[model samples]
Target: MIAFEPTEDQRLMQDAVAEFAKATLLPRTRELEHARGVSEDIRRTAHEMGLGLVSVPEAAGGQGQGLVTTVLIEEELGAADAAAAFGLAGPGAFGRAVIELGGPERAAELLAGFAEEGGWDRFGAVAWSEPAPCRTHEGFATKAERTDEGYRITGKKAFVGNAALADRFVVFAQVEPERGWGGIGAFVVRRDNAGIRVGERHKTLGLDAASFGEVVLEGAVVRDADRLLGDGGEEGFTRAALRFFVKHALVVAARAVGLSRFAFELAREHCDTRVAFGKPIGHFQAVAFTLADRAMDVETSRWLVWKAAAAWDAGQSERDALLASARAAAHAFEATMRTADDCVQLFGGSGFIRDLVAEKLMRDAKQLMLAAPTAEQLDQLASAIELGQKLDPALVLPTPDTQAIFT
Candidate 1:
């Protein structure tokens, strides 16, 4: 049996984050969406409130919390503004990776700057995904060569979060050739480094307020001090130790569930108020049943998130079963997106209009799917676990012989 009861401290943190979201973040989301940028005031507020550095270690410069806490807080922010929600994902992921993978000197240096004295805010972004022949770390083509100074990296990474705004990037590059396992390594590259350029800005569907664009690195020089995980070794051991996939995915799942909850509440409110023919529309079984089903899915997924998060923190060794947890979360998120669309349809023209925020939530849910270790990937992992074999990192699924699995 799995349980998701929050401790007293966690409950307090959740309430505080929810209150802050309602009072400060939610109101400005619309304006920020139109502006496509977060103001310094908002950043400062988040920093002072300890929102920006929540997962970072207290030893260096963070709150020293775990995944469950991070997910809970992100849910409140995500419901208010998806761009802000998306913005935090990178910083949180990168912060953990740095703390776990970076050498002591490098970790200390980066974390201190992240603490942000007074009003100066510093955020970290990871340049992991790339286009063509290389979609993620498994198919990485970027390379870093050992030079007299340190390392010179040259590669193009697309869809790098906060590319335009971040002070430093945890650049992922291939360090070993053809021995075939140095898969990826992270190097801390500063914005002012020579040959490092922020490419075209993209106005994405939902996270338009957050900076989304490409990062081009041409012979970007990195000193030995900047080299984080892998340390010129195969397998990128340091990075793998960080376990970012589960951490980021759980927070993302929480946000999707939160948005769906908001949609459900709005739909219920609308059903009770709007009358069709004689009585309230909610009295109709067809409308009420669909709402009830969606509500159950949201709650179930939310609890599952909490369970997996707890397991991950406790260092539970359920490798074979963990993939299923990720799959369940993905299904829940997908269901929310579908249900939110239905909510829009139920509201008729009013839903389509810019008056209600349901349409935005639907769009936000769609955009969240862009984060990596996609649903298809999760399915592949499940397939591998079922087959009792180590899944090839590069295997694309539906497995060609899809019939074989069923037969």
Candidate 2:
């Protein structure tokens, strides 16, 4: 039987995160936007709440929560501040990739740091997007060459989240240029590496508080032990990448739903109090209908997000999970953007100002829309799956570049 209600533990977790969002994230949203970064104190508080370790298994010193729980937390956080939610959840992607593909010994060694007193003081990032115009279809331009010691990676990754602040980066590179994504592999590159360069920050449309930039690797040497799927070759890497992508898509969908809900609430409140023709604007059919439509959109998107998250937790097939997540993300992105626009309309001139959050919600919605596996791409993927076409293993899976939004 299908269940829409959250478990007791899940409800408790949701409430806790909701309270934190109201108490911390909401009040700081404007400050962080102005600063263009989340404070270290906020980051530490997030870690202390176990947001960073939500994806890690209990045996690995994490809470062992599933994707559904993580999405629930993300929704609440995103409602308060999208960038802060992204910052808090960003490290989980890297940590999960390590646990899934790096073997138990590697997972133990790397995750141990997360258990330290401060709790993940250093940010984690994945470098996957390339500066090349054909990056989307052609895959990464970065190359990883086999070496006696391990591998030498040389390439530039564009639009990497946390590039300026990440202490560790999970970089993706092709071992054989001719093979494209089939030759891709993932390697852990520390920020302190001699040949690695963190580039200037990129000013984005939204998620302003989260750092986004480029990472350049010029003959950076990586030890064999640092390779996530050492000796498992491209096949192993591709499989792990797909799993990560599906998980990330679901989380992004959740954020969209949250942001849309926030916009809807703002619009609803404005409609209720604002006077028009000697009465509340909400009494007008034109205004009331838009709010009603937005309410429907937000509700629909929320359910879709939950369904995708639930499929993942239920151990559904990768194709099924991916399809669900892709569909949810694409729809949620559209819905949220529309809702944000309607919110702006409801607020009239005030909505356009920075003081009003409606404008910010619209900006944030656009960022989510453009984030990884864009709506158009996701629709195509869904159509391809429906027709039983074989997906390009790498194309369907999330790349370091494509999956950066979830971070």
Candidate 3:
């Protein structure tokens, strides 16, 4: 039931995206880096192409094209400019969070606005990470106290993507503090919410085209309807949340695959042209072997990502899907870093210069590794599932209680 070949329809879409990447993103990568965000025209183009809603369910005002297609498109985007993919206007992580945590019914109402007029200017984010762990509780520092009409959320969420741009957020908070990680709850908090405001943006080593900042909720209240109580309580909600993270990581891994591919190609081209001792550098044993290894890295990462994405699409068990995703993502993330590093190494002194893209690739690859759960964390998850151990909420997934990952 596992298929590596994309559908004919998928091939067409891939080609179209590839062309857009080459013509638009690749050329303007430096421009995006300087601008510190995706240009409005490019964001508008991506929106018109339905790039943001590709993986969303049809019932939730999306294409419902499934995860496999999503990874393919993501790879194309990453190959051109991984940073711009994050900067693209759309629900992004917020859409995936709602779909996993709230289901289609709630997502329909919350997500329908993304397709409206001027929707290209809209963005949504998942406020999952925190500035620091809650010292008193075993979960998030952010708390949600029950109120007459709803719950009032209060705390600071850091490393949140599109924080300043997102009008809507799926904010995670400590609901039943006594229950620890099990007490966590998710709420839909709008930017217009009286007590919610964006804080200072972080300047990172890479992915400058995307904004990562803090969301401070000093008693932001959400109505009862805003609660995304998946299947209802602790275990169910935790399971759904874990699934979302793994699937989201898989999507990020596909991008890593593309980054690896681009790096490998860039290195190989340099090796073929650059002469070291009278012949092309690629003819040397060391350089040739490195290129060969990176070639394997690209193909291996792509297949792993495809298999994991296909598992979800094919209705595999949650444990199976999670395990596959963890392995794929872990491998892809490391391979991307290695490939980019080698790409720089092959370029000698020139790679370090800003005039070349090698250094940027290296930095982007490193930053991307943190955009989701780390390879180390993912390996722990894979091992936990393999050993048949009870999946502890804190141990099996990245949480505010443990490592605060960028989402």
Candidate 4:
């Protein structure tokens, strides 16, 4: 009974993003890779196209696209370059959380600034990961104690994505040492906030252009207005945080699917033209079958991502099952990576060289696994299924008007 066909509007949206990615993004991959940072031109083009603000609701002065649309755009950009796609998509995710969780005045102020600026120089990076025992915010060593002036935050968060250029971070800290994540609440910490410091940029095997660093807070002071959703001492912030985590996970999955497809096409082209034994190598069963399997995996991952996004967009509370969709995607992505590596092997030595596109594609393919919860963490997500627990509540966003904030 479910319809899989995308509407006319959806198709148009998808094509538009794909065109932008090919025309504006692909050409810049090498430049970004070498520069090790985002390019102003790419950012400007994304801002002009409204891609930087895609997830912001229309009321918030953005395109108001849902996760499905976001992923579609993400796929195109990711096919071109993962870091650039992330630079475009990560901010939108941050803005969405702000609109849903921050105070009205603060949210309006920030959203207005975002609209005026076209796009933020730094992307929105959520600082949630902490050292052991507090993994996933279940417990945290960071503390944000209420003070006479506001709150004094003291904690350290590691490996925050986009931390280098992030203007502000959504940070989780405990008000009571006894509360753990339950006692945990979120606050907005600005780059210049007292005692807030961004640490050394780290290099990774892939997504080289994507900025990763640490956020340190030592006696950092933030005003009360900066407190997110549950500042009134409720679990709303935790709810909002989980929703975003799940959404980011989906974005990662989409990027994996896109890059895999890109690799498949490249392999196919090689097979058709590269003569082997006086004929195209594609005639060989090994190469042909591998490509076919890779295509199957890519298509399957794409389907799961689309379904997951649609579920979230429709406000379906049953969307928790979509976590399974994310895991399926991770597996498919792994398969595609292996296939792409094999395809590169099919290319002989050309695949290992710098001029060949397959080499870069292989590098980017490895990056998809590290995005967000990582493949290992995503695999743990399936544990809920084993425990006979539902993932639905994990996917739902908290309705803003359902509770009184400063009451």
Candidate 5:
């Protein structure tokens, strides 16, 4: 039978990450927000704490943790500060992808530096979004033209996580337009390459510490050896991309659950302390019911997040994984936003100000909603799965008003 409780090692890992997040990430929230990026000291501390290598395989000099453990760690870190968690988790996700999909030599090269003695000093990124009318999976305008030497990639990717500081980027581009989604390929390009340019950071509503920005490939050339999955062709590329997207969706869901839990706890504590008419606000029926509703929402979302992570760790079929992830993403998004809004409401006037963290959590929840595979899109994917339709993994339903929003 499947178990809901974490294993002994998993429990220990969760506790350790929770402690580290509270001690390190929570204390620096204000500073990190002002800086618009996590400090080098905070990054190094995360590395030393082994947070950067939790998901990398043991063969690659990492802890060899599974997706479930990674989700647990992410939940705690996100509870402390979602933006800080993203900064630390982003490279680990890239490292894991390389280990799983990149060819032997490519994996060795990337994993070697990732396992460096000092820390995971080298940043890695994945560029998938592009400047195009269609931002869905089939809408990628970036083209990879074959040449005698290798391939020349030309396009601009917007909203690239960790772009400003990334040393390596796994760029997605179309290699065979006639083949549609199957024609897409992921090519590894170095930041210092001849035509690669990292754009200025974009001012976002939240998750500022993630350093989200643009990456431009003006005919950036790379040899065949640089391609993830090398000669595996379109099928291989599609498989790798789908797996990564599913895993990423689950992680984002876990983060949302964590943020929701954090907001609920803060609101609960505030309700107990803030008194009105000689009694604590929590004693009031309206305040008590709101807190109760949010507590239930947080618990429900947490279970959904764990269910998706557990499905992934069990090696379920791709369709099953996608369905679980989509459900989790949709539920987590709604729950987190509702809980955050309730938190602000509970705080009354203080929540609107910067002194309290309720407003910050609300902003972070909104930013997460805008991230890839939005709640509406995930809901569509889930609906397709239920109907036994094998929809394109990158295909997102477009509404008239939201058509341009994805780009």
Candidate 6:
């Protein structure tokens, strides 16, 4: 039989993070948004608590916890402030990319110094999404050419998380144009490189505390050793890359579940207190039913996310995990949006006001959906897996050819 309950250790960590989120994040959410970043004090506190390293391997200078634990903590953070959760300093998507694309051998070398003192100020990013797809090939417009010194990369990546702050980046580029999507390569690009520069930050609708911007690689160069060619066995690099994106999306999905929970709770609390027709609004049938529906939404999304996370930790088949992740992420994205929308509606005009967090949650829910592979993209992935179709990275993964999703 399978177990859905979190282990005692997992519960302890979850509770601790929940406490921090409520005390530190809940109150300063607007402050973080107005500042357009997480505060130094909060970052330091989160870092000290090992929030950034919970799912990383010990060899990578991290806590060696599983994805299950990571989601639990992420949910807590998302419940209080989803934007701040994204803004917290850490390797983040960059770490997940390296582990999957660069192989485990490089994790120790690439992930160093992310967990040490002053690490709160350090960050890493993945430059996956481009401003537009390549018209010539079914891949990124960014090109990386082989050079005697390594490779010369030229391109612009957009919608990158921590773009303005990260010094390290996993920049994906076209390696063999004829091979199309399969020819793509990922390289470790340093911000200080002579040819790389960060573009202006974007004015996003939500998740204001999280920075998203562009990175311009004007003939940037990297050594051959900097390239990440995963040992993907017979299935090759495409499968590995897909795995990376799927897992990354699950993390984002877990956060969506928390956002759903937060919105549902907020709406429920309002219904309990706000009186209408001579009693609490919740006493009415419509209000009570809506709350019940949202309650189910929260629970369903949580279980789906948990099962997907558990599949990864349990080392299930790649197909099984991929399907689970894709479905979970897609469902959570839609559920979060619905829950937030209903929350705002229940607020009866008060939700539109920034004084309450309903409007913010609604905005965040939409932004979070695009923050990863996206519900539409994930649905496609799940269909491909369930139908036993060929797993093409161009089709399943969140590529520029499909959609320029935020990383």
Per-residue lDDT tens digits for candidate 4, residues 1-407, read: 95777778878988988998888778888888788877887787677777777776565567767888878877877777876776653354456557656744556566655555645464676776553344434356778999988899998776577777877778777776665445667788888886898877667667777776777899999888777863343445554555565677777778877888778888888889999799999889998887788778778878878888887887776336446544655575576577568667878889989888788778767766655555554555556545655343222222111210000
Give the Cα error of residue 358 in candidate 2, in Å: 1.0
Backbone N/Cα/C clashes per model: 0, 3, 0, 2, 0, 0
Minimal lDDT window, size 10, model 3: 396-405
Q: What TM-score should be assigned to candidate 6?
A: 0.98
Q: What is the C-alpha lDDT profile of model 5 across 6-59, one tens digit per residue? A: 999999989999998899889888889888878777778788778877777666
Question: Which regions in candidate 2 have their CA more than 4 angstroms from the true location?
Answer: 103-105, 134-137, 230-236, 394-407
The regions of model 5 sitting more than 4 angstroms off are 103-108, 134-138, 229-236, 393-407
Ranking by lDDT: 6, 3, 2, 5, 4, 1
lDDT of each: 0.68, 0.79, 0.90, 0.68, 0.77, 0.91
TM-score of each: 0.88, 0.92, 0.98, 0.86, 0.91, 0.98
What is the lDDT for 220 in model 1?
96
lDDT score for residue 346 of model 3: 95
lDDT of candidate model 3 versus the reference: 0.90
Q: lDDT by residue for model 2 over 308-346, one digit each (tens)?
A: 888888999978987888788889889989999999999
Give the better candidate number (4 or 5) by TM-score: 5
- The window of 10 residues in a row where model 5 has the poorest summed lDDT is 398-407
Give the Cα error of residue 36 in candidate 3, in Å: 0.1
Over the stretch 216-314, how does candidate 1's per-residue lDDT look in tens digits? 999999998787763334334532432455456666677777777777777888889899989988889998897788788777877777777777667
Clash count (model 6, backbone only): 0
Model 1 stretches astray by more than 4 angstroms: 1-3, 88-90, 103-108, 118-120, 134-138, 179-182, 230-242, 318-325, 396-407
Runs of candidate 3 with Cα error greater than 4 angstroms are: 1-3, 400-402
TM-score, model 3 to reference: 0.98
